[model samples]
Target: EPEVTQTPSHQVTQMGQEVILRCVPISNHLYFYWYRQILGQKVEFLVSFYNNEISEKSEIFDDQFSVERPDGSNFTLKIRSTKLEDSAMYFCASRDTGRGNTIYFGEGSWLTVV
Candidate 1:
């Protein structure tokens, strides 16, 4: 089965640096989302995008974060200024359809900020 794939399963960065986490969503899906889990916390939705525009975004998606579909297959999340609280597992997810559809997660891109 096709699955979402994330790069640099483990990332280490300083407290005030930039980081780009990459993801390749399922080929035939139309919607893309980014979720984050801060250590032992519940999964939190950051943003969702479809058709080249943002569908929804949570408050957690503040000024320092951005998402882009650089091409047909790649979806990327860029953090302009990392913080200690930014240490978390960043997940890339996608759903083929809506209305009771479930999102699938990549193993996760673990970001560690010191």
Candidate 2:
């Protein structure tokens, strides 16, 4: 079976710098999404991409954030300016064309901004 892979497992960046979180979701997945886990807050939705366009996104995904599928198999989230509050565990997920929505998460990429 195939699985998603993130380029960097952990990242530390300075505030005001840019950061790109990458992930290769399961090859057969038709829907892709990015979610985040704040230390003491609920899991939050960031954005969802399908058919090369954004299908849905939360208010959390502001102008500073963008998602793209650079290549057919890779999905990425770019943060224009990193902020300390942006530190969190970013998760990439996708699901195949099935009857039920069973999303699989990548080994989440951790981001730390100082």
Name the candidate that leads on TM-score: 1
Cα lDDT of model 1 by residue, 3-66, tens digit: 9999989999998999999999999889999999998899999999999989999999999999
Residue runs of model 1 more than 4 Å from their true location after superposition: none
Task: Estimate candidate 1's alpha-carbon lDDT, on a 0 to 1 scale.
Answer: 0.95
Clashing pairs in 2: none
Candidate 2, 26-84: lDDT as tens digits: 99898999999988889899998899999999999999999999998999999999989
Q: What C-alpha lDDT do the candidate models reach, one value each? A: 0.95, 0.92
Winning model by lDDT: 1
- TM-score of every prediction relative to native: 0.97, 0.94
Residue 97 of model 2 has an lDDT of 75
